[model samples]
Target chain A: MTDRQLKIIEIVKQSGPITSEQIATLLSVTRATLRPDLAILTMSGILDARPKVGYFYVGIDENNLIAKKLRSKKVEDLMSLPVVVGEEATVYDTIVTIFLEDTGSVFVTDGGFLTGVVSRKDLLKNAIGGIDINKIPVGIIMTRRPNIVMAFPDENISDVARKIIEHEVDSVPVVEHVKREDGKEGYKILGKISKINIARFFVELAGE
Target chain B: MTDRQLKIIEIVKQSGPITSEQIATLLSVTRATLRPDLAILTMSGILDARPKVGYFYVGIDENNLIAKKLRSKKVEDLMSLPVVVGEEATVYDTIVTIFLEDTGSVFVTDGGFLTGVVSRKDLLKNAIGGIDINKIPVGIIMTRRPNIVMAFPDENISDVARKIIEHEVDSVPVVEHVKREDGKEGYKILGKISKINIARFFVELAGE
Candidate 1:
């Protein structure tokens, strides 16, 4: 739908039972053009049209609406499969996986649980000037030593995006090995969240 | 570095002045076979060598140690620039951006400030199915409402990760619209976080 159509819907929601003629006048569109919009909205389940009357808001299926609008309700729906590495991994081993997998960072784990995170920056920083990549262990260059960015798969992307951006960081590590209150880890490493993910969901959609 | 090398480093770091034969005994390699391994590690700067005593642990450096084994550091040293998206969008638009960018999600914002986030699932569920993608206002499909995943640019990635897990999210959104303490809004989206990013850093330098 075009921006005008959305605007029309918003207007209708704000002022329902509005006549097509009234809408056309407000939007500077002809009544004929308004008819097509009304039809489109009706077909798309956004509105209910009546002859010799006006358009009323079409109540969405609560289930459908919830599924669409609430990320908190379904944040893990689109997460990718999870894969992790250990902190004890050698630089060569880490490099092979990173290059082969087309990934930018790797989560370092201990006993199947997240211990820390390492990114290209970490590797490059060590490799570029002072440290040599071949012999060094991953333990010395990690950004997670004093702190770590982490995620539990059950979360929504908005919360995750806020963390990455707020800290000026990239990805987070998944710690499925940790025991939960029920003696089970809350979630697994479903996938990685990125700025790109947010952009695809919001920016691109908004543009269209 | 493979798991094999990582073990070697751990053994040395924990117990230095160890011979290649002794290292091989623990790593399932023969003393003769471990010669190349020892050579490779020593040349890489992860280990120090002596003429007759044995090989010892090289001081920890970015290149020589594993990330998880290292002391945690700030994210500023690891995170990259942020990626952002506009607030208004359609489902179709979102699909195009997501596939094009290869990012997991995008940051949702208005006038350069982050408002919230929307994921692929957010678009698929909200914009697809019965919802009119072209007309429905994306502002309504925001996930993790009210900018829950908040972060400051100067903060560390580790700090952000901890909060992400604590907040139970896949990623965090970066913002710069700071409002005075008067309950006004002042925040802009700068970037995002994901497990992939953190995971990538921990890998060895061989791959990107």
Candidate 2:
């Protein structure tokens, strides 16, 4: 945060429940300059302001605020496009897919719908055996649907982090429910969220 | 940053060349409460203060601030313990070591000195080639030193981040020169800094 932001916080702590007009008068700044600062402070939960009342100190336990921010965040806020491979792709093809993407896992899809998931460990186990990698379809060995953990765009980010850590998986496909042409329900893969994304988010937060 | 902190920045921007006493009186806050905030703002380069003049606006563009912060941060601030394995350890053993530590890379050491580094990609590549995992030592395939990018404790974090991205490696081992019992010079492994560490540090900054 900037120095001005820090000072604003200190003032609120000392004199809040205080009004923006009072704050502006004291800081010798016009409401115009304080507008953005106040908006950011309130939006970030550093200050709580009421319509008729005024701005007030939100307390310090910034870690709590950060956790709350993460909890309320949606999957779409951080999701990245999933690296996918067709279900019919061969194990050798899957190896190429893994290397090309440089990812630990890939979603197996059939016509843009998620069907299963394959990871490096699964492919490595296959490669260690004497089987013909070129002839074996990855779908035959993938973790099939109904077993895969997923998130919708609107789901909480905290829940997504839980799924990744709990499942001991590198990435989770973010899928949305859609009606098929035949009137059947199916999931359309939109993106993926990995531990790296979470870490990056945390880094961004620290900068704030 | 808190609301008061934001106010301070605004005040400095609008009235800079303003004094601490004037800031304290305007905000009705004690000098004690404002002390730490000023120090952090100055230290982070968010505000430049002159001895008799006072604090002034440093401008927006937080990316610049964050980059500066990263560039000056020491490796010790971001380091974690190195996950190590003996140089003679077999590829199969290295696989087990990778799983146990759950790290993307491991340092190959001999007699407590750095030797080489191995990553998951290396092991996966080896596993896919149908090699004798049990008999082949990982040292044979490891990225040997002079090739391995490392950081000293005092090295800048931005430099570390650059090395990792440039080398396309997941992490860098932090090392320091030391004297051996036999009065010979050697290097000592101190810790490891990975992409995750960088992310976590960023998150912490946002919270502050």
Candidate 3:
């Protein structure tokens, strides 16, 4: 979050369900500047308004609105793709690929169907106790049914943050907003956006 | 994950349910070095062990053991702390703290219970339409019931990546490993672990 936004929230809390017009006057800022903040607060589910009265704080659980909004954000906007993977040939071959690709998590797909996921830990755990890394089918050791976390293309940073909170997962996969109509290919793996990505994205956005 | 660990896995995957002594030989490393990785893999549920036969990969889709391990790594370890929130008197007041603190996220706790969270976007959303930021209580306007993400203290880089992949949230609230025994107060808030932190940390670790 930016400093200005924080300042604005302070003002609102100090006063009672005050009007935006009054706030603009008190803050000496134009309504236009304050507009974005108001929208964000409402989206966060913290703001409640009456026909004649102004907005007031709801409950502490109001963050749910923000969490819901985060889910709406597309993973594509956040994902990076053409994911690197080691080919499946033999156990030894897969072992070499794990190092060459240099990824903690690697995707294992056959004919591009999203077959499975493999991580260094997966390989290591299986390999302990003199298990064969070279001969065994990598498929046997790979994570089949890899948990797919996704993100939408157009969504707010808040929405992403909320999703992270709600799901308690680290990252969401970014699938293309629109897949091929034919459905010949599954959703292209755009990349992944995790809670960390959201954290850094905002830090950079805030110029902090 | 570390390169040494990967090497150990490769040796085992190629060798088979061999002894750790055999694994140590193939990797050209001591058994002591391999022990930690072996133990980790076995405990993570990726590798199943036999008293005499040795360990084997349980196959994929069982639950990303490594990812799950890293998922437990706390955001507090990765997150920044003394989180510095503005006086939570108004909805608008949050903006000031956001801007001044130069932080995107702020925690709100009364008597250290973590009542709510406020971000710059939260302030922006509320400040619009001449919304009075001061009058709106941040606790009321702030995000309540935020999705909680956690991490353990002994997290590796891969674990960080997995958390991002699993949770898809931007920021994780790093809390103490041991929760408060009696009440929530003992469970102190640590800094945060963000994607950026993970990325940066990995970059440094990789260099080493």
Q: Residues A14-127, candidate 3, lDDT per residue (tens digit)?
A: 785888887788878999998877665544344555656776665222223223333434445555543434346554565456456533355665655555665443453454
Task: Determine the TM-score of chain B of model 3.
Answer: 0.50
> Judged by lDDT against the true structure, how good is candidate 1?
0.58
- Candidate 2 chain A, which ten residues in sequence have the lowest lDDT sum? A59-68
Off by over 4 Å in 1: A1-70, A180-190, A203-208, B1-208
Per-residue lDDT tens digits of candidate 3, residues B1-208?
3566556555666666878888888778888987877765554344567899986666323122222333444443554554645335676455555546645566676655555566543454455324555576777776664455545455543554556556554445555534456655533455655565654432322221
lDDT per residue (tens digit) for residues B83-202 in model 2: 999989999889888777877789998888898999887888998776899999999989998788898999877667666656777789999988887887667899999876765554
TM-score of every candidate relative to the true structure: 0.36, 0.61, 0.34
**Candidate with the larger TM-score of 2 and 3:** 2
TM-score of 1: 0.36
Give lDDT tens digits, candidate 2, residues A49-83. Answer: 99878999884444443454556678899998788
Model 2, residue A202: C-alpha shift (Å): 3.2
Task: Name the TM-score of candidate 2.
Answer: 0.61
